[model samples]
Target: MVDVTELEQRCADAWPALVDEPLGGWRLRAAGGFTGRANSALTLGDPGLPVPQALDRVKLFAAAHGIAPCAHVVVGAPVEAAVADARWRVDVDHPGGAESLVMTGTLRGFATPKDRAAAVAGTPSPGWWELAAQANPTTAQRRVLGSGSRVGFGEVEREGVVVGAVRGAVVGEVLHVARLAVRPEARRGGVARSLMGALATWGLEHGARVCALQVAEHNSPAVTLYRALGCAEHHRYRYWVPGA
Candidate 1:
């Protein structure tokens, strides 16, 4: 079984925040409000202080950074209870859905798609950025998207045009996958699966054996696709905010 705490830490490392700090074992992250994962406090472990005190620091950190005070907490975990006891309620208005699932699969066992032609590259190509960003990427988005120590970018092209893109980062033996996008015209094809395979191959060479990803619970299509790839939910987490 995957260790939830360790896996969360690796996920954080893979998709790093531009400004991250440690409050004991807890991670306070901020990335200019780029994405929820990069901008929330990861309340997964002990903070070496009273839970209430740690919660206070979380509020101060977010206030100082001009981002909403949010906590990335695992559902049913001890920290979740502690956070709720401290009166931090779930953020119903969270930009990203309030709940998400972290799924894991062994890279070697990932389903093989027929069109495994996503070209893997060490650096993101212009076309890759075009599809992934859908517009000029902000400085914070660019930094976080390209920040991992061992990152691989994958894209599929057709008729000299990019149709799909994905990003993967390797930390320890796990490959953290994110930012998968497929052009509307290319949907229902093997583009997504191909991208996953290509990135998995790249991740293997970079010392990753398992693949992990976070997807919103409400994204049925994504949930179905990942399930088809033999991924199983390792855990679920919710975003919490200061309660009324």
Candidate 2:
């Protein structure tokens, strides 16, 4: 059986926050509010304290980090029930959304023909960073996306302009893919699929077998593409915040 909890932890490490602290088995992460995954508490296994007490710690940690206290709770996981029992409700306005899916699959199928392949590099190109951030990237975005141990940055160019970009971070045997972006004028031309293929190739060279990604439920096009790549939901997580 695929251990969803273990995979979740691996993903967390792959997308590391600039400031990471542990509360027993849980992770309290912050990265200048760059993304919810970085700013929220990862509520998984034993926290080494009562759930309520642990949540108190989460609150304190968030306060110190200058972000709201939010717990990353997997749907149907025991910790989710405990957190809900502790009176924390969903953060309906979470920037990422209320829920997201962690999808996993092998890298073999994402390969594209060489001619249509994206160019993968060990470092992000200036254009890649700009497209991924939609602006000059904040330090947090740059660090969190580019600071991993073994990472690959992929991009597709058209008429001498970079039109697509993606990031892949290999953690052990798994490759975590994120930060995929394509210019509005570049969509519908298989730019994303090409970048994914190149990322998969890079991950394979780095000894990764499975690929994973997180996507919001409402992103139908992305969901469809990933599904076509044979990725399936390993688990789903939601952000919970202080509420009744």
lDDT of 1 by residue, 154-200 (tens): 99999999999999999999999999999999999989989998888
Number of the top TM-score candidate: 2
Candidate 2 worst ten-residue window by lDDT: 108-117
Every model's TM-score: 0.96, 0.97
State the number of backbone clashes in model 1. Answer: 0
| Candidate topping lDDT | 1
**Alpha carbon lDDT at 165, candidate 2:** 96
**Candidate 2: pairs in clash:** none
How many residue pairs clash in model 2?
0
lDDT of 2 by residue, 135-198 (tens): 5788889888889889888999888788999989998899999988899998998899889988
lDDT of candidates 1 onward, in order: 0.89, 0.89
